[model samples]
Target: MPTLASTNAVEIDGLGKRFGATVALENVSLAIPPGELFGFIGPDGAGKTTLFRILVTLILPDQGRATVLGRDVTTDVWDLRRRVGYMPGRFSLYPDLSVEENLRFFASVFGASVEEHYDLIAPIYEQLAPFKDRPAGALSGGMKQKLALCCALVHRPEILFLDEPTTGVDAVSRREFWELLDRLKASGLTIVVSTPYMDEANRCGRVALIQRGRILAIDTPTRIAESFGRPLFAVRAGKRYPLLLAVREYANAGTVFPFGDALHYTDRRDGLMPDAIASGLRDYLRGRGFADVEVKLTAPTIEDSFMARMGEPERAA
Candidate 1:
């Protein structure tokens, strides 16, 4: 089969999409290399779905251009459809159908059989094998996710687009789903995935931090976290809500936000030592009559970097 004509499996130039007065996507441009696992990191309404739909030919862009496998998305959508696999954010399979039946139906759509491409989906399918006779709607959230993935891969497409594949699933299922993607990547399938989870960003080979339908930063997770360019600290105490507000009111607080059980923060005082900052934070919380407090230097994470980028002004890429 003929594949992409260039090293890039997907390319977008100034892509824009709007629904009524709302801008679903704005001037989005990106290049996805062949056989690479690229992630579109963002929350809901960040235009991740809109961009994916355009690339998949499910919708048309109001402006700009995009190509899939080197074929124009607008004019060559049929060809693109045949070469790419897309697992939408929703589980759109026939819920009433049994697992094997659904898989066979999707395979037939692409004029292929599940057995013909079983190896491509074996890792994920194996997890759902026992439930092959169960109705899709009756399966667990994790199993439904796996079944959707198998249906998407049944035709052996060269590239895969997964939109928020982990949302609503349990933590263990989410991790397992990503592990499956990792295996797929190792097998030379180019994959594009979108997720709101910051930790999932680290699992991708490269990620594009997006917000409000714009690209914030595009690089490996390590580079994006390192670009924070601020001394970060984590503070925790009893009464987490009040602690968050109190930390934000600190005079030297550059950026403050609750992170898991601790508040991830940055100091505004440019050259202040970590010890001094921690001391000041501890004293401030203590002075407010709260005895329990722990403030210390903490490494910046992908969430911290994403929040930092969210606060910064958008610059031209």
Candidate 2:
């Protein structure tokens, strides 16, 4: 049996799982160092939740091995459970319970007290203190997430696993939640978070892009975007739909996809200067009667890299 490395807070090798005909994870492998803010970036059904559940000891993997904090997920589950804090994707606390009740309940589960770990959750608890008397279900989305986070942290676990902690919250709330995560990371906590939002990748120290039960790439956000390694341009015109179609129909078009309010275009020909490619594309659109066409060279984003990788053939395990 392979032993978990001492340096890794979490480790998985050839981890896999399935639900009858549905494959949740396939040949997944990765290592997370302690105190790192690691992120699993993917859309829904990409196996992020499954991977998290296994690490948190909620479920067993069908094959391969995984360990959290040097404890085997399958063998040392009882000890691991007490050492890790997990905030599931869904709100699992009693909706009828008041905010304070929920926090106290979770603390007691691990044989701890809210007063014992009060310092750990003080920052987040202060916000929820005002709503301590309100039913958990009655709080706004942001407050509910904060309360859930408090419950998860009340036990003072060595590592934290949050499954899409910011999903379904308002944009302002999302930003605030990330700020809280940043503070936790600075406090030397190893946090493993999964989210479908590509923009959030920037906040992670390192991220793994998972799709269809496999990892496409894993690196720092900037490096992952830089790996898109092809001349790319963002083109916009009066009509986005027509512009997308026209760009896709271009003979030299390598990849064309609608991004935000513009179309991100890549060319088939390599080694061509970006300015030349942009000029040629502008002329082509002008000739096609899109008089107000604007095509400019733009840097690739993490989403662009994910989209590009999604089109390639999957690697062999």
Candidate 3:
């Protein structure tokens, strides 16, 4: 049984939800401490959106229970809605409305004015102020996101839930968005964000990796990468395709997947030293007619850990 703690900003126990034949979430449970910039990391269709909807009081769970800010999400939904801010995965603000209109409208919905909580959204709102007259639909992807975030913050809710907030945005915009999140976290706002990008996981204080409606792992980015617990190597060759196929055919290969420009390889046999493994892999690749093969022991990243966990057998629900 999972228990909720008063100290926790958000808590869930044995939470499960299904959509007809599709299982959206299954026995998910976790506790997020207050003021923490927590993230739910996973690829598309990994139950991230469903979980966020439940936390933000937009949907009811089929089983189990969840509490946000010590209030039951299922029973205290109306109260929770008033205290929490949610920015859905899609752009939900009115497209025909000007930026300022959208902000004022959302503020009024919460029975508050933009002036009352100006300080809460100043950092982000300042950027949008210049384009206040512009229709939200006419703004760039990044600007639209900023506008949505400002609206979400206008009421100064205790916690903010952002679902894939950076998806479809430019690379530079993604970086800028995370910086805004850092500043928000510094202001002692508890933020719960979900993203499909593995690199974004590093920005979170802690992250939960979800796949196929199940929680695979949860920990700091560094700790999760450390948990890979295997001798890994980055193998690169002039001929990428051939090298990948060759490495996959190796007898000791546990996992081989293309990672950026190199193929990250892990061995099935344990107890072999890193140096010995690297040398063996290099020799094997060289024997396969790849004279330009470069094999080196490499530190595992959060993506590596995610891939490893994803390859494991699914846990029984």
The local distance difference test score of each candidate is 0.90, 0.93, 0.93
True lDDT of residue 313, candidate 1: 62
| Local accuracy of candidate 3 as per-residue lDDT tens digits, 1-317 | 33344789998999999999999999999999999999999999999999999998888999998999988888788888999999999999999999999999999999999999999899998988889999999999999999999989999999999999999999999999999999999999999999999999999999999998999999999999999999889999887898899999998899999999999999999999988998898899888889877889899999999988987754432
Residue lDDT tens for model 2, 1-317: 65455689998899999999999999999999999999999999999999999999889999999889998999888988999999999988899999999998999999999999899999999999988999999999999999999999998999999999999998999999999999999999999999999999999999999999999999999999999999889899888888888888888898899898889999999899989899889999898889788988889999999999977854433
- Lowest summed lDDT over 10 consecutive residues: which window, candidate 2? 308-317
**Residue-wise lDDT of candidate 1 within 50-69, one digit each (tens)?**
99999999999999988888
Query: What is the C-alpha local distance difference test score of candidate 3?
Result: 0.93
Give the TM-score of each candidate: 0.94, 0.96, 0.96
Order the candidates by lDDT, highest first.
Answer: 3, 2, 1
Output the lDDT of residue 33, model 3: 95
Worst 10 residues of 1 by lDDT: 308-317
Query: Which residue segments of model 1 deviate by more than 4 Å?
Result: 1-4, 313-317
Q: What is candidate 3's CA lDDT for residue 134?
A: 90
